[model samples]
Target: MTLLLSVALFGIHSLMFYLLKINTDSYSYSLLELYGFFTPIAVFIIIVLIFVHRKNKDAVGYAFMALTCIQMAANYFMLHPMLQQNLRPQKINFFILFALFLAMETIITARILNNKQ
Candidate 1:
């Protein structure tokens, strides 16, 4: 179910961005690349969360919590170059994609974290 949801969300997210790009071409930050890069990482996180939830239910949340800091650093690294630029649209695109995927990842992790009940 997690994999399926990720794939579906990936498609929808990609398609939504493409449609938005069709209307205006100011966005050149390679937001799709950002999404492409993180999608797999997100899946891996969910998988590890699941395994931890199974092997050590008590550690699943800790693992994810620890992972969140790494994620923040990684996200900053990826956006650092873009941050140097003064393009508002590119920044907007980056945040939109970032928030969408982050929310999805959070929901998946929340499901795993709550499964202990």
Candidate 2:
């Protein structure tokens, strides 16, 4: 369920970026393009996690949580330069979306950890 929700959120975020014309610069465009690459890989990983989780919950759960953390870190690294340039509304929108994803990932991580105990 969490994997599905995460995928949905990513899809929504990507669609919002396209519909809003937020990728005005090369850097931002690159970020969006990176997401274009990442979303499918993430979906694949999450699907595999779902299957692995059914067989061996602990290891795969931890691995999935770690993958989410790595993804969040990558997001920060990609957005950091863009955030430094200016405070445009579109940039703010990106920040808000990033925060939303961060919150969701944190909550999912917490739930995974809680379930382990």
Candidate 3:
């Protein structure tokens, strides 16, 4: 789960950055720079949570849930304002990713809890 989540997260972030470069209309170096900060912090937190809670798979799911919640908040407050746009494609995708991450985390947690019982 950790590996899969990490890959997904990396791929999305990379795609966003790459797209920003190719598209002049959506270009915002300041926003990209801020997102860069989030990228590293997210990676660090995910790695730490995965390793530190390796023995407990359920705990890993919880960590992902927590991270997703934080990411959602960051997306709304930091990313949204910096972009200075409403109803953009990138904004839509951001919410989609957040929902997907939340769903995955919730399912994982439910499965883990069931297995324990």
Better of 1 and 3 by TM-score: 1
Residue 87, candidate 3: C-alpha displacement in angstroms:
5.3
Model 3 stretches with alpha carbons more than 4 Å out = 8-72
Strongest candidate by TM-score: 1
Q: In order, how many clashes per candidate?
A: 0, 0, 0
Q: How many backbone clashes does candidate 3 have?
A: 0
Better of 1 and 3 by lDDT: 1
- Model 1 is weakest, by summed lDDT over 10 consecutive residues, at 22-31
Model 1 agreement with the true structure over 1-117: per-residue lDDT tens digits: 545665776678669868866443554445457657777777777788888888988898799878777877888988888788788767786777667667877888888777756
Over 1-117, each residue of candidate 2 has an lDDT whose tens digit, in order, gives 545665676678778769977755544544456546455545555566656666777777677767777776877786677787765765665666566555654565456446653
Q: lDDT-based ranking, best first?
A: 1, 2, 3
lDDT tens digits, residue span 1-117, model 3: 644664666577668758876443553333345445454655555565546465775577667667767767766675556368653665655555456555655565455445643
TM-score against truth, every candidate: 0.77, 0.51, 0.46
The C-alpha RMSD in Å for every predicted model, in order, reads 2.8, 5.1, 5.7
Off by over 4 Å in 1: 1-28
How does each model score on lDDT? 0.74, 0.62, 0.57
Better of 2 and 3 by lDDT: 2
Where does candidate 2 have its weakest 10-residue lDDT segment?
Answer: 26-35
